[model samples]
Target: MFGDIMGMMGKLKETQKKVQETKERLNTVLIDEQSSDGLLKVTLTANREIKSIHIDDSLLQDKEQLEDYLVLTLNKAIEKATNVNETELAAVAKEGMPNIPGMDAFMK
Candidate 1:
């Protein structure tokens, strides 16, 4: 019983290390998303911080349309960043704890 407990503790430490490494890597990754017409684009880090935005000059002619496109593009960028973060985190969790049910949820 004591040996099993020690093994589990070691596994937990490894999982914690993996999660920290994943979070650090995510901070450096970026995702880009664009509007349907490609008139607007947004770039966000994996941690959901907006890095930059691009807008076509033609879209500036109409303020309302430009605003709408900006919103849409930003949302798309956030969604993409979230998806990438989740995928990477999930991979790390799976590698560290393959049989632990709801390990991902527990991490959060």
Candidate 2:
């Protein structure tokens, strides 16, 4: 029993290191979106950090239009980021697991 415990501890440490590395990589994931008319663009990381936004000069004269485009573009970018973030995080979660011979049965 003691030997098994020690072995499990070693695996746990390796899993922790993998999870940390995966978390760091997760922060690097990014997604960008643009308006259909090409007047507005928004970029954001999977962690929800806004990287940048670009707007065409023509949209600046109309406050309402610009605001509309901003909302639309931001929503699109956020949606994409959310989808990508979830997928990436799920992959990391899978990675964090050590493939034990019988652990799958236990997990189920």
Candidate 3:
């Protein structure tokens, strides 16, 4: 029984290490998302920080529309970033513990 407990502890430590490494790798990733009209685009890091933005010159003439488009594009970018983050996190959780029931729920 003691030996089994020790082995489980070791495996848990290994999983923790792998999870940390996975998070670091995810942090280095970037996701790009854009608006339907191609007038606005945004880049976000895995940590959801806005890394950069782009705007087409054609939208400059319409300030109101440009503002609306900018907001829409930014929302799209954020949504994409969130989806990517969730997917990556799920992958990491599965890789770390495929048999651990409800592990992801606990992690979240």
lDDT of 3 by residue, 1-108 (tens): 999778778877878887788678867788888889777888888768888889899988999999998788888777877887788777765665646677767666
Q: In order, what is each prediction's RMSD in angstroms?
A: 3.5, 3.4, 3.4
Candidate 1 wrongly placed segments (more than 4 Å): 98-108
Give me the runs in candidate 2 sitting further than 4 Å from their true place: 1-13, 98-108
User: Model 2, poorest ten-residue lDDT window?
Assistant: 89-98
How close is every model to the real structure, measured as TM-score?
0.79, 0.71, 0.72
lDDT digits (tens) for residues 41-89 of candidate 2: 8888877789999999999999999999999889888888888777766
Ranking by TM-score: 1, 3, 2
Preferred candidate (lDDT higher): 1 or 2: 1
- Please tell me which predicted candidate would have the highest lDDT against the true structure: 1
Q: Which 10-residue window in model 3 sums to the lowest lDDT?
A: 91-100
Residue 15 of model 1 has an lDDT of 88
Say which candidate scores most in TM-score: 1
- Give the candidate order by descending lDDT: 1, 2, 3
Superposed Cα deviation of residue 98, candidate 3 (Å): 7.0
